[model samples]
Every structure is written in C-alpha cells, then in structure tokens.
Target: NAGVTQTPKFRVLKTGQSMTLLCAQDMNHEYMYWYRQDPGMGLRLIHYSVGEGTTAKGEVPDGYNVSRLKKQNFLLGLESAAPSQTSVYFCASSYYLLDTQLRKLFFGSGTQLSVL
Candidate 1:
C-alpha cells in the first residue's frame, strides 16, 4: 500500500507562475501537513489539517495554501510563485492512537520546486 505519495516529484516555474502540489495517503490518517525545507534550515511547517474539511495555517503559510477536501487527499497551492519560494516541499500524515503516546509521521518522498 502506498502510505503517502506526492506528485510532480520535481518542478520548475517562472517567478510569477503558479502550481499545485498533490499529496495522497492510503492510510486513514486524521492529521495531514505540508512542510518546506530550505538549504540551511530544517523543515518548516507551511500548513496543516486535523481532519477532513478542516485546515489551519502553520509557521510559514505566507506564500502557500492548503485544502483537505477529501479524507485521503490534501492539496497545496502556490498562488504567485516567487524565486524565494524555491525549496523542497514535503507532505506528511499521522494518526494519534489512543494507546500510543507518541505519533509517528509518514512522509512522502518530496517535491523539489524551483522558481526562477
């Protein structure tokens, strides 16, 4: 089973072009997230959703938006792409089990995006 998958593993766009990153999960997870990793920085949370039809902004949500229309799918959108937005984007999902104290995150391979 594909736990988590991301489409368009790599992409290149002009400074003002727009694009959407698709994330899919076969696991019935209640929590989903989008994060971006820069050259010298750790992964930064861009947005997250606790459950289907529910979404929230994360640490770095300025240039990005997310939607959780379906329980197994989450979509991240870049409205107006910028050169500064060049980074590797990652999608993750997890479920909080009642018997477990710690949550285990399942991550997608990742999407490399370049805005020039």
Candidate 2:
C-alpha cells in the first residue's frame, strides 16, 4: 500500500488557466522528480528535489514549477497553462543505493493534461 499516488488522473485546461498536480509517497524517499512525457522526447525532467524544502530545475523547467515542502510529497504547478504544456506528467522518487551507486525510481501512473 506504500507507493506514489497522483490525484486527478486527467485534466483539461483552457489557455491561461492554472492548476497544481500533487504527488505523494509513503516510501520515505530522499529524492523526488517531476517529468513530462511527450510523443518522442521520452521523459524530460522538469524539476526535482533532493530533500524536503529543497528544489532544483531539471532538463525542461520553463513552463512548470515544483516544490517539495515535505519529505513524502512533491507538487508540480502550472502558473498559466499553455497548449505547449499539454502532456503526461509523472512523479518519481528514489533513494540512493550504495551497492549499485545509482538511484532507482518508482513512478506514479501519471496525470494527463490537455490545453485547448
């Protein structure tokens, strides 16, 4: 029962509208990330946080913002939604593995957003 959960699996927005997508986890992960999946771009990172109260921009952070106010939750917000922002948003969390020297991510089902 402990995993990532994203609310409002789908949404439709008008131009200039705004909304926030919530991502929560009970796994006590140290790192959390927000990514957008496009037709052929794969998953491009929008933002991420290493720990609570810290955030950083990732590959594509222009039209989106993210925050990690709690260790178990990460929020992605759109100030003014645009058509170009329509895509499948995903949330992931992971902890560093000493043996593998890599972080394994657990992702949410994803929220599909469309702007018209």
Candidate 3:
C-alpha cells in the first residue's frame, strides 16, 4: 500500500524556533500539498506544488514555506516557530486534484505540533 507519509508524527517547539517537516509518497504522484488544520478554521492550504521543481503559495502561505524538488517528496519549513503556528500539519498527495480534473487524495495520519 503506497501512499503519503509524514515524518515525526509529533513535535514541540519553543517560540522563535525552527524545524522542517518531511513528506514522502510512493505513488509517483505529480501533485503534493501542505496544510494546517486549526480548531475552527478547517483545513487551510499552506503551499502546494503541481510537479517537480516548482512550488506555489496557497490560501495561508504566510509564516510557512515549502519546497518540491523531487516528485516524491515535499518539505515544509518553519523558520521561526510561533504559538499560532502550533497546529496539526498534514502531508497529502494525489494523482490529480479532485476539484481540478483528477480526483481522490490520500492523507497521512498527521503531525501534532505544540509551541510555547
């Protein structure tokens, strides 16, 4: 069963800290995404890349960064951690965007993060 997987299922960071979350997939998908789920804000996209060697900001791209150098891997980086940034980070992969022609997505369990 090849699908999306996230590294360090849990993490804790102090204010103004830094960290990098890794996401890998084995489906040879062409699209990858990073999102943060808050208490009531639902799932907001932080960044997404349509294919290798390209990346773009999403609905809530501020305070976060992402890179997609390899088609199978996407990385989310936090330069300075903040309390507000403490939320579940999810790594997702899809052969195609459900809303954009291709459908269905596989999501990893999640990364629970805490910031102080």
Candidate 4:
C-alpha cells in the first residue's frame, strides 16, 4: 500500500498560472497535511485535515487551498502561482501525533514547483 504520494512531481508555471497538486494515501489514517519547503529551510505547513470533511489552515496557507472529500485523498491548489510560492511541496499523514507510535509523520518526496 502506498503511504503517501504527490502528483506532478515536477512543474513549471508562469507567474499567475494556476495549479493543483494532488495527494493520496491508502492508509486510512485520520490526519493529512500539506507543507512547502523552501530551499534549505524546514517544511512549513500550508493546510491540514484531521479527517474527511474537515480542513484547517496552517502556518502558510495564503496562496493555497485544500480539500479532503474522501478519506484517501487531499488536494492542494494554487489559484495563482507566484515566484515566492516556488518551492517543494510535501504531503504527510499519520494516525495520530499526540500519543502514538505512528505519530511519526510520513512525507512524500515532494513536488518541485518553479514559477517564472
């Protein structure tokens, strides 16, 4: 079973172009997240969902939107891509974080997005 997978592993966009990155997992976990990693920096959360039908904003959600319509998939959309939004996007999931072994976050390789 795939833990977490991100689509459009690499992408290039003109400033103001729109794109949506897809994330999917088959683990049936209750938590999923979107994070972007700028070069040489730590991952910053963009959006997250604790379970299906519920989405929440995170540290950097300004240029992105997310949805979790099913238990297995989460999507991150950039309505208008910008040079500053150019970064590697990673999606993660786990059963829990507060008190569980599976609390260890699992990450996708990430989508390398570039905006010109």
Candidate 5:
C-alpha cells in the first residue's frame, strides 16, 4: 500500500505561474500536512488538515492554500507562484496515538518546485 504519494516530482515555473501539488495516502490517517524545505533550513509546515473537509494554515501559509476533499487526498495550491516560493515540498500524514500521546508522520517523496 502507498503510505503517501506526491505528484509532479519536479516542476519549473515562471515568476507568476501557478500550480497545485497533490498528495495521496492509503494509510487512512487522521491528520495531513504540507511542508517546504529550503536550502539551509529544516522542513517548515505550510498547511495541514485534521480530517477530511477541515483545513488550517500552518507556519508558512502565505501565498499558499490547501484542501482535504477526500480522506486519502490532500492538495496544496500556489495561486501566483514566486521565486521565493521555490522549494522542495513534502506532504505528510499521521494519526495521534492516545496511549502513546505521540504521532509519527509518514512523508511523501516530495515535489521540487522552481519559480523563476
């Protein structure tokens, strides 16, 4: 089974072009997240959803939006892409374990986006 999958493994865009990155999971997780990785920084959360039909902005939400229409899919959209937005994007999913009080995230391969 695919734990998590991301579409368009690589992409290049002009300054104002737009794109949407799709993430799908077969694990039936309750939480999903979108993160971006830059050259010298760790992954930063962009957006997340607790369950289907519910979404919330994450640490770096500007210029981006997300939707969780189905339990197994999450979509991240960049309306007007910018150079500063160029980065490696990763999608992850997890469920909280009540007994352990912890959640282990399962990450997608990643989507590399470049905006000129």
Candidate 6:
C-alpha cells in the first residue's frame, strides 16, 4: 500500500536464526509501532517510535529490537528466532489531530513469520 509497506510478506525461519522486518510509511505520520498478532493474545506491541531517532519498548519488547533512523522507516529485528515468536506482524503509523484530540493508525498488509 502507499501508506505503509512491509517487505517479505511471508517467511520461514529456523531456531537460532535471525531476521529483520522492514516497515516503510509514506504518510508522514508522527508515530510508528510494531505489533505481533497471536492466536489468543491478540495484538501485542513490540516496539514504537514517537519520532525519528526515538524508540521505546512496548508490551512485549523482549526478544526483539527496534530502530527508527528515519521518520518514514521503522525496523524490527529478531536476534534469535523462536517458535514463540512465530506470528503475524503488523506495522502501523499514526498522526495526531490536535483539534479532535485523536489519532488514526494506518497499518501495513502484515508479515507472516514462522519459526521452525
């Protein structure tokens, strides 16, 4: 999509292997987030960035790392892939509306990752 794009729509990784998920947004949003979708846990935040060069941990930051070197790009890295890490990952960007005191998120198509 034009708003957000995630590379490698699907992937299969072996235990102990490493990989990185790339997220790019063209909307010029102020906030970017990385989330993983599990069966019953729903969407769990992995990491987020409020702006360029700023990164923060979220609900589930363990086993993952993130970096926001540019305003339009956010990267999620897994040093060691595991079965528990297998899930559908989503990248989203949002912009705040001062007048309405609200924000809207634009999500990527999602990446399906399987750790064997």
What clash pairs does model 4 have? Answer: none
What is candidate 4's CA lDDT for residue 58?
A: 100
Q: What are the TM-scores, per candidate, against the unseen true structure?
A: 0.96, 0.96, 0.93, 0.93, 0.97, 0.96
Give the Cα error of residue 12 in candidate 1, in Å: 0.2
Error of 2 at 85 (Å): 0.4
Model 3 residue runs over 4 Å out of place are 97-100
Q: What lDDT is reached at residue 115 by model 5?
A: 97
Q: Report the C-alpha displacement of residue 83, candidate 3, in angstroms.
A: 0.5
How would you encode candidate 1's per-residue C-alpha lDDT over 7-105 as one tens digit per residue?
989999998899999999999999999999997899999999999999999999998989999999999999999999999999999999888756889
Best by TM-score: 5
Weakest lDDT window of 10 consecutive positions for candidate 3: 96-105
- 1-116 per-residue lDDT for model 4 (tens digits): 77899998999999999999999988888899999998688989999999999999999999899999999899999999889998999999888756554576888879999999
Candidate 4: Cα lDDT at 65: 93
lDDT on C-alpha atoms for all candidate structures: 0.95, 0.95, 0.91, 0.92, 0.96, 0.95
Model 6 TM-score (2 dp): 0.96
1 against 4, candidate with superior TM-score: 1
Return model 3's CA RMSD, one decimal: 2.0
Clashing residue pairs in candidate 2 (N, C-alpha, C atoms within 3 angstroms): none
Global local distance difference test of model 3 = 0.91
Displacement of residue 21 (Cα, Å) in model 1 is 0.2
Q: What's the CA error at residue 102 for candidate 1, in Å?
A: 2.1
| lDDT minimum window of 10 residues, candidate 4 | 95-104
lDDT of 6 by residue, 43-93 (tens): 989999999999999999999999999999999999999999999999999
